[model samples]
Target: MPALPSFATFYPLNHHHSQGACQCGSPILSQFHERMMADISRRQFIGGAAGVMAMFAGLRAPRVLSQQPSDHNRPILLKNLRLFDGSGGPLREGVAIRIEDGRIQALLANGADSGNAEVVDCGGRVVMPGLIDAHWHTTLAGISQFEAMTADPGYVHLVAAKEAERTLMRGVTSVRDVGGPSFALKRAIDQGIVNGPRVFPAGAMISQTSGHGDFRMRHEVPRSADSPLSEQEKQGVAVIADGEAEVLRRTREQLMLGASQIKLMAGGGVASTYDPLDSTQFTERELRAAVDAAEDWGTYVAVHVYTPRGIQRSLRAGVKSIEHGQLADKESVRMMAGEGAWWSLQPFLQDEDSNVYPDAERQESQRMVAEGTVRAYEMAQHFDVKTAWGTDILFSPRNTQNQLRHLAKLTRFYDSLTTLAMATGRNGELLAMSGLRSTYQGKLGIIEPDALADLLVVDGSPEQGLDFLNDPKANLRLIMKGGRVYKNTL
Candidate 1:
């Protein structure tokens, strides 16, 4: 076996992925090295290389979120675009984007040019930051929505890879997977084992039994209540505990399992049948335990809540964000705002010809499908919440594309421009990332110099109407992520 690079040369964080390589010398060590380089983000790369690369700014960036072009040095120019920077701002017409080192080098105005770069004429089409959905769930089961809630990690990760591509087609280049079985699936996506969104995944969802992710049926598990899931089942996918101390242990356990963030079910969910959406299960101690554990680990916790009581406890715990607040009242919204936690809403439960269900289940779900979403939207808008686009696009027994039309319609909550930000810039901020608007560095959500090179060019400007963006069949002229052209035919 070849001698692999030193650990300090590779990462500063000691992000040891023992499952694969990172061992001093193993067979196929080069394969592990290749994956280590490909799998790591600029941030992770810097962490491993902290001492060696500290003199270089990008290598030692404090936030590790700087948009300084570090990939390659030459400039690549794009011309003739109508640009939306995703700051709830107006679009710029006839603009040009300059990129280098896989970062936006600059965004020139309509006739603006730096004069020393290669250019591709966009033919007056719209250019925007690649879309990003902050609250997406990739580990789901069934050939359709009706099949069931699960499959194995390998099966689901493979399935998720396909969904990730579909999202890119819709102009979304990055996504934050809210929860999954473990870090394995997210590691697969991030390491380029599969091609899809730039995934920031929260491995395994933490839950108290009867909370949102508790899948245990009393009749099924005859083992002790304290038996942790088998090695076959991990904390990353579906972990359930009972009391506060137990939940607290699971919280720390997940961080050890390669999680960069934490996810807790504060209450019930529409999908999980046991707990009512309004019931708040976690005590203040449990909430504090999760929050403290996450704080100690250098990450944030995103709580899943659908009702007021659940929302209240989540606030007490100081979670960073809330997902699918289908029944939050105005006070809860205001409280969330005061607490500085953002909201991620999926006003996308509706679509034409996209229904799936057993006859009776479908009929019962219809009532929930309609009322819960409508209320969620109304509260988000009324409270002036930091609500952004988080279409929980589930593709299994159901087509993910069908639900998007509602997101388009929901754009009426804010102006069309702000709505686009929900899908791009605002969503980036919700992910707790920095530098999304045009002027900042380490950009993720816009097209400009020194920004990430994720872009979507379409025939019609989505700002013209939600329909232009929502139509799955809409004419997308090109899709690029990190300067790689994944799709080009219009």
Candidate 2:
């Protein structure tokens, strides 16, 4: 074969130089370049480029929880419990649940024989489904903004790991991770490398430039056309995309990365600085691009929006879930009911558990959201809109310890039973909107035959009040997820 062509001859010097092609100014350098190029054939170079492209395109196999053989085959019997069932129904007593293969095999009648299984006596405690937080930020809930923006990605992930275990110990066994770089944490939990809840991940919060998901500093604005993606975007914390084409591309990227659902920033947010509370972000066409991309992947889109205009735009774009609609008006609430969309509301009561913002404007915005939250709930109830509950705790490690308290705040709006059901079954139903994109395959948020075995055995009745949840270490006598006992005090 003819000698391999010189780098400058095969490609223009400027183009090759910019791409890190060999620059041989001396005879020795030229010989070294020739030897290196001869060792790596054109086929090898093309194959290497294809592998890099594949990595960037996210074409790797999805990381799902590999079933542990021991857990998969072992049968477990949980006896002597009052079943809350998570169906908004009265608790049923004297039932024992049979669990196998990470699911409830059967609900045995009183005194039924349990053969060859480990029996756990719950001592007449109230057994309920593990909690589901529909709008959680798994990786961001426990870290400060300064740390998240400036810390190493590995350190942030370690913080998230500790927080995940805390969340699980608090009796929240499943969470719909609305934003953040949680894929690694989620994989760790699934593989039993870390103890945590089931994660329904939306890889990143997709936003238009200057939108709610945009976390760039003011000085970082006026981004050059050819500038690289920001650090946060590269880390999967958030992505800033513009226009229909860019939105479509960004949404697909998340889907390719194993996002169970897509999260779009369609309106202003208190956590973000530049966007006003009343301002809408993505246009209907741009929102539709994301929706269409998610829909094609057998999943749905949930939008971060609050104002009526933003809510309406998202709904028209086929968004299935509306997150943070605390400022929604009556017409918007009615539209949500008409469209049968999910209202993923948080109890933004401006209480001790609320997110802390340094500036007065954001504080005022928080107060406004809190003021509208009660009315928003009332309207949702009146219109019979489907509602799911979450505690969007952010940026405070201390506030994360109050997860149960934030959940109990829902009792101020509804009775304890309704509140419990909202956090359990209702939120699970909302998570099911992910369809085929869901990572876990069994049922969640209910104590029924064949439901996934995520359970909490409480010492007292939650029907009267959720105060017991405020003390998980004491009152939550037993906690089980995927048929494996994580905590047992009974």
Clash counts for all predictions: 25, 0
lDDT of 1 by residue, 160-255 (tens): 455555666667677666665424444544555555567665666676766666555545456576665632123234467667787788887767
TM-score, every prediction? 0.76, 0.84
- List where candidate 2 sits over 4 angstroms from the true fold: 1-73, 146-153
Q: How far is candidate 2 from the true structure (C-alpha RMSD, Å)?
A: 11.5
Best by lDDT: 2
- Candidate 2, residues 1-490, lDDT tens digits: the string is 3343322111100000000000001122122223333434453465654422332232122322222223446798889888998888899987899988789999998589989877778888898999998877776567765565455433545676778888998899999888755776677688887789999988767888877666665566689889877654654656888999999999998888789999888887664456777889898999999999999999999988889999999999899999878889999999999999999888877766665556797678778888888899899999999999887766567778878877787888889999999999988898888888998987899888889999988987888998887887788877889988877777
- How high is the CA lDDT of each candidate model? 0.58, 0.75
C-alpha lDDT of candidate 2 relative to the true structure: 0.75
Best by TM-score: 2
**Candidate 1: stretches off by over 4 Å:** 1-74, 109-116, 145-157, 221-235, 348-369, 395-398, 403-406, 433-441, 472-474
